[model samples]
Target: MAIGRAKIKSVGAAQSPLLGAAMFTPAVLYILLLVAGPFFLAIFYAFSDARIGNTEMHYVGLENFRSILKSPSFRIAIRNSFIFTICSQIVVIVGANILAIALEKTFRGRGFIRFLILLPWVAPIALGAIGWKWILDSIYSVISWVLVALHFYKPFNAPMWLGEPHLAIASVLLVHSWRLMPFSTVILLAGRTAIPKDIPEAAAVDGAGFWRTQFQIIIPMMRPILSVAVLFGLIFTFTDMTVVYILTAGGPFDSTQTLPSLAFAMGIQGSDLAAGAAISLFLVPLLIIIAYFMLRVAHRAEVN
Candidate 1:
């Protein structure tokens, strides 16, 4: 009897992991169907001849990818995607860090300020971009009027923020960062509060000044959350389309076009489905590398 009881206990313990995995099976299946499945289809289409307005697909065997590689616009889109992602991530991360620190302090109207800070994130991106579109309009821009009123810019004249090449790219980055910084700020704020006050207090007693304590103790402790914020920011900014579509439409001679927008134009608008799939898959390699690094960083931070 004692032997039988021990055998039963061992059997139950051995099944626990299997049961746990079974519990998560639904989520696993959902991701496979909705995310991984579509991605595999896109990868397949990238190598095939799948034109828009056609129900038939023929295997072209790398012709689509070869054509994409030979296209000048593909190169331009790749460059624009990198520039936009890097610039927006820098602006958003820095802005969020400063804002998070400010919000950590107890001050008058702090609650109201926090509410206002998050308004951009709450607002729909399409709506926000459309609003910015008018504000950046060459003829009837209130921002232009305000600048003219300040005598800092010329009156009765404004460069088309969405029409000029450099200005349009800058405008897209500014809008993307503006809409995303609040979420990063909230994440960093959570990280800040998670830190034990005694740690910083002990560092202060060790003759560490404000900046020294922040660098030595605070940032190290906040590393995990910051990594999360940066990873999220990089992915979203890298693939964003709504801001560019509503504001610039890849205009000023397609100088402002990023990969996502280019993909949309090719697949949906231009009816070059195979080429679009190739463009869409172009970033997969970079995204996989980034995700791996982010996981490693997160794991290391947690272990430390």
Candidate 2:
């Protein structure tokens, strides 16, 4: 047995660098061709005066960022993006955690219920957001009709969900939260189920109440899983413009504009490639910082 184990270890240790490189070459090429390639292009464009359909790019240091800083639209985009991400995640994490716990226990129709929960994540974002657009529309909205039928408001006074500033933000936030919850619940559910039944059973024997077991024992163990889910959710909400675009198009009067939407408008619609690239790149530093700390926390949890 010892000799066999030694042979296995030696075989693994004998893996050549060239063989390793050959095995990993595809992934390296893929990243370079897809991810790193576009990123470097964006950086290059950010420092130059470039525009759509213009081959000529003049060297302009910080000019694009300077213009973006001076734009009120950019300022609003920054505020809205942060508010949207933070608010949606706060609601999603708590709601998803509860749903995950509920779904963990066996029950009738559970398989069907889980399928329903997974629908949004499986559905394309554009399709889901477009469906939401119709739902939020003033003329043909099912929600508005339902509320009116319930005597919540007269037809003329029904809330214009996509028209008012605060209402528009809230509406989009709800859509994002709904779309994100399924993924969060699935991940958290996995985390919850990974805990040995013996641990919770022992806690129960120790007279731990439901709340005590959840808060003290279960939550502490689920920290790493929660961190991963939150990080992904944060990045998704922060970078997503499809919901805002389809629902409100950053209206009424750009009140719902997020950084991604704003960048698209400036870069594609407004035809200022440099400014758009600069606006989008603003997220890089912030996302990097967030990913670093979250990963550190995850590593610490893993160690414990």
Candidate 3:
């Protein structure tokens, strides 16, 4: 009986890997179909002379990429994309860390405060951008009206939040930061909570002041999670188009145009699908490179 039971157990154990593969097969197929299919299609479009309003696509070699690279507008879009992503991430990291630290502390109505902070992240980007547009409207801006009421600026002279290049970029950056902050804050808060309680207490016992402990111990130990937060923030901000589309739509003389916005304009609106695909492809390589380095650093931090 014992020998028979042992044989049955061995057979069951032998099937475990197969069972796990079966369970994961559905997800793998789903990703390949939905995620990879579109990606491969985009790659094909980038290399071909695919245009809107026309079904024919011919092999164009590197023509689309070369044209986009040589285009002055494309260059400007690249610059604006970098600026928007970097500035927003800077704001996100600093603001998120501070907010996370504060929120992680026990307090009255902590849940409510967290919910309010998370609203911007949970809300749909398009919907949120529309709300912000109303607040920053050119003609009937609440901010402009409030400023005028406070004697900060004259009527009809309020700053054009989306009409001026500098102001437009700044507004987009602020909006992106607002959207990403809650997510980053939550990530950092989880990092903070994951930390062993004894570390902070020991730091205090060692006469480490608030600044010293935060800078020297807590921050260093949280490197992995911080890198992840920043990585996510970079990816989101770098690839984002919704906020820009609804808020500014790469307005004020293409000054606020990022790669995604420019692609939308040229590919969809201008009917140069190949060029738009090429423009969007510019981000993929850069993103992959960044993610690789960041992940390497994060891995090292974890090992340490």
Cα-based TM-score, every candidate:
0.87, 0.90, 0.89
lDDT of 3 at 261: 93
Which has the higher TM-score value, candidate number 2 or candidate number 3? 2
What is candidate 2's CA lDDT for residue 194?
96
What is the C-alpha lDDT profile of model 2 across 1-304, one tens digit per residue?
A: 9999999888867985677789999999999999899788889989999999999999899888898999999999999999999999999999998999899999999999999999999999999999999998888889999999999989878999999999999999999999999999999999999999998999999999999999999988898889889999999999999999999989988899999999999999999988889999998997898889788977887798
Q: How far is candidate 1 from the true structure (C-alpha RMSD, Å)?
A: 4.0
User: Which candidate achieves the best lDDT against the true structure?
Assistant: 2
Candidate 1 weakest ten by summed lDDT: 155-164
List ranges where model 2 is wrong by over 4 Å: 1-19, 297-304
Q: Tens digits of per-residue lDDT for model 1 on 1-304?
A: 9999999889979997998799999999999999999899898888888887799988888888888889887888899999988888899888898998899989999999999999989988889889999989978888889888988788876667777888888888888889899999999999999998899899999999999998888988888888889888889888888988888888878888889999998888999888889899988998998899888987887797
Better of 1 and 3 by lDDT: 3
Q: List residue ranges in candidate 3 displaced over 4 A.
A: 1-22, 293-304
Clashing pairs in 2: none
Runs in model 1 deviating more than 4 A are 1-29, 297-304
State the C-alpha lDDT per candidate. 0.88, 0.92, 0.91
